[model samples]
Target: MTNSELAVKAVIDTWNQTIARFDSILDKLTDEQLENEVAPGKNRGVYILGHMVAVHDRLMPLLGFGPQSYPELDEVFLTSPDKAKATPPIATLRTQWKEVNANLAKYYAQLSADDWFGKHTAVTADDFAKEPHRNKFNVLVSRTNHLSYHFGQLILMK
Candidate 1:
């Protein structure tokens, strides 16, 4: 395969691996454990889960796919900090996580190497022309780092 194809596969693989790590971690934690804070006076496991779901949901629109599946999550998980608003149940958040990622995976599979290199919805054409690095692939790479950051925090619960 070409270098661009290889690059796309590498990022996609890393993304899937990160998702799997979260799935494994989440599966082991009970709802009661999810109630505990990741650190003293810090965000709770439930809040983090909801936060991730909210963030990932927005990726759809940001990447020019469509509207979010769970815009409601933004208020509780994104706009507000932990305990600022009530979050969905652990079970519900877990389900939403699976659904959102699965949908994104389908969308990812549909992209060509050129599509991955194209600007996402958040960028204007002029800005993209000036800053070609601000593309869809960069978003995924940054988000993978975001997820990995949370993964480190979340694992503290175990």
Candidate 2:
């Protein structure tokens, strides 16, 4: 395979691993545990879950997909900190997480290697021509890192 294809595959593998770890962590938590703070007086598990959902929801536009379905998630989970007016229940966020990840997986599975390397939502085509590294693949890499960071924090809830 080409080097670009190899790199893309590696990124997808890493992202899939991260998702598995996150789900494993979530699977062990009870609803009561999900309400507990990772650290005392800090963000709760529910807040973290909602925050991730909001962040991943934003990835759609960046990846050349349509807009997010959960704009309100931005205000409660993204703009504000935890205890932000009672984030969604664990069950609800879990449902959203599964659906969002499923849709994102479907979209990513359809992209050509070239499309993976192409400019994401923000950059103009001319700009992308100049700076090709700012692409959709990098977004997935960065988001994977973001998820891993939160996964560690969430794991502390148990």
Candidate 3:
């Protein structure tokens, strides 16, 4: 495979692996434990899953994917300053998490070499300025990086 192809494959693999790790963590939690916050400022497993889904959902669309089929991103990450805020039940959050992960994987798997290398402009929420963003390959890398960062937070909650 070409370098670009290998890069894209690496991104996809990393995303899948990280998401699977999140799922494995979630699977071990009971409904009550999913909502249990380990610290004053930290979120529980359910909230972390919801936040992960939201972040991926938003970033995917920015990379030319469709709107997330799940709840709003803010609802998960910004609903309240307190991490103990009420979130959806564990079962429902798990279903949504799975759906988002599947959608991201499907979209990412369909990317071609050109798609990975194509130049694209990214718009920040702060203003109308559009920054030159990396190709889809880099975007995928960022996505996985973002996921991994949040996954660390999730692990810390344990």
User: Which candidate's lDDT is highest?
Assistant: 1
lDDT of 2 by residue, 9-42 (tens): 8888888788888988898999898888899798
Error of 3 at 9 (Å): 1.3
TM-score order of candidates, top first: 1, 2, 3
TM-score of 2: 0.94
In terms of TM-score, how similar is model 1 to the real structure?
Answer: 0.97
Model 2 collision count: 0
Q: Give the per-residue lDDT of model 3 (tens digit) for 44-89.
A: 6667777776777676666777765664546646565545456666
Better of 1 and 2 by lDDT: 1
Off by over 4 Å in 1: none
Per-model clash counts, in order, read: 0, 0, 0
After the best TM-score superposition of candidate 3, give how far the Cα of residue 52 lies from its true spot, in angstroms.
Answer: 0.8
lDDT of 1 by residue, 1-158 (tens): 88998999998998999999988999999999999999999999999999999999999999999899999988899888898887787899999999999999999999999899999998999999999999999999999989999999999998
Instruction: List pairs with backbone clashes in candidate 2.
Output: none
lDDT of 1 at 121: 92
